[model samples]
Target: MRIRIVGTGRAVPAERLTTRALEAKLSLAEGALEAVTGVVERYVCSAESQIDLACAAAALALADAGVEPGAVDLIIGGCGVPYQPLPATAPLGMQRLGMADGAAAAFD
Candidate 1:
C-alpha cells in the first residue's frame, strides 16, 4: 500500500540551553561542542512528560493536515527508548490526539 504524510509539526520546551552555555557549564572550550555536534541550542523539559511533548506536536500536525482525530486511520510513535517502559506511548498519544479507542490503530 502507498502511504502519504499529510503534515508535520515540531514542539520544544519553553526553556532552552544554548551550546555555548552548556560549554561553560561543562567547563569545555566555547564553540567546541557546537563545532562537533552542530547543535546551537536544546530545549530543557522541566515538568513536561514525553507524552505531553508528543501530543503538542501531534496537535499541530493534525491542524496542519486539516484532519480531525477520528479521521486518522493509524498512529505510530517512536523514540530512542520507551519513555516509561509501560502502557506504550502510542496509545497515550492517540488519546491525547483526541482519537477514541478503536478509532485508529496505534503502535510504537
Candidate 2:
C-alpha cells in the first residue's frame, strides 16, 4: 500500500498579536508575555470566528490535494477554541467551504 499526504493545512488568525500589543493590553512588563508563552508574536483569531479560519484552511488543503470539493471522503477539524459554545466547528467549515451542505461529521 502506498500512503500519501493527500491534504495538509494550517489555520492562522487574521490578526497578529505582537509582544508589544500584549504588553499594552495586559499592562505587563516588556517581553513578559513572550517569556511566559515563549512566543514573540502569535496569530490571534479573536477578531474572526474559529469556523471561518477552519474553512479557509480546509479549502487550501483540498486545493493542495488536487481533489474536488465533492470528492472528500472525510473531514476532520480540531481546535482548542471553537467559535460557539455549541455546534461543532467542522460543520460550519464544511458549509463555508461549499463541500456538502452540512453533511460532514465533525469532531472536537
Candidate 3:
C-alpha cells in the first residue's frame, strides 16, 4: 500500500500564557522555563474543549486536503485524555467533523 500525507492544520486557543507567566506560576526565576523548554508562550482554552480544538484542526486539515468530512476513511485522536469516558475521543472528533461512519484510533 502507498501512503502519503495530504494536508495539515493547526488551531490554538485565544488565550495565551507567556513564559514569564509560567515562570511566575512555577515560582521560578523569570525566563527559567524558557531557558529550559525553549517555549515562549502557550495557548490555553477558555471555553473550547480539547475535542473542539481537535475537530477544528481536523476540519482545517480536511480542507487543506480538499476532502470533505464524509470522505475521511479513518480518524486518529492523539490527545492524552479522552473527551468522554464511554466512547473514545477519536470517534468524538470524527463525529464532530461529521464523519460518523469513519474508523477511529486514539493514541496518547
Candidate 4:
C-alpha cells in the first residue's frame, strides 16, 4: 500500500498581540521583546482554547480531504508550547475531531 498525505490545515486566534503592545503592557523598554526574541507579533487566544484551535484546523483538514471524522485512522499532534505535558495532544485532537475512543490511533 502507498502511504500518502491527504490533507493539511492550520489555525490562529483572532486576537493579535504585537511586540510593541506587549512591551507597553509589560512596561518594558522599547523593542525589548523584539530585541530579545525577534518576534514582532503573535496570536493570542481571546475565546478559544488550545483544543478549539486544534479542532478548527483539523476540521478544515477533514473538509479539504473530504473525509468524515469516522474515516480517520490516525492523528499526529504536537504543541509548540504544550499547555499540559501529560495526555498527548493527538488523542485530544482526535476527540475534538469527533472520533470516538479507539476509532483512531494517535501520537504526540
Highest-scoring model, TM-score: 1
| Candidate with better TM-score, 2 vs 3 | 3
lDDT of each: 0.88, 0.74, 0.78, 0.86
Comparing 2 with 4 on TM-score, the higher-scoring candidate is 4
Candidate 2 error regions (>4 Å)? 1-4, 101-104
**Root-mean-square deviation per candidate:** 1.6, 2.7, 2.5, 2.0
Poorly placed runs, candidate 4 (over 4 Å): 83-86
Residues 1-108 of candidate 4 have per-residue lDDT tens digits of: 676778888999999999999999999999989999999999999898888888999998989998898998778787887757777788888877778988989878
Instruction: Give per-residue CA lDDT, model 3, range 1-108, as digits (tens).
Output: 776779899888879999998889899999888898999998888988988888888888989999887766567677666667756777777767765553444333
Per-model TM-score, in order, reads 0.86, 0.77, 0.79, 0.82
Write down the RMSD of candidate 4 (Cα, Å). Answer: 2.0
* Deviation (Å) of 49 in candidate 4: 1.7
Candidate 2 overall lDDT versus native: 0.74
| Model 3 whole-model lDDT (C-alpha atoms) | 0.78
**lDDT per residue, candidate 2, 1-108, as tens digits?**
654669877778878888989899989999888888888888876777777677777778888898777877566667776667666677667777777664655556
Candidate ranking (TM-score, best to worst):
1, 4, 3, 2
Q: Return the candidate ranking by lDDT, descending.
A: 1, 4, 3, 2
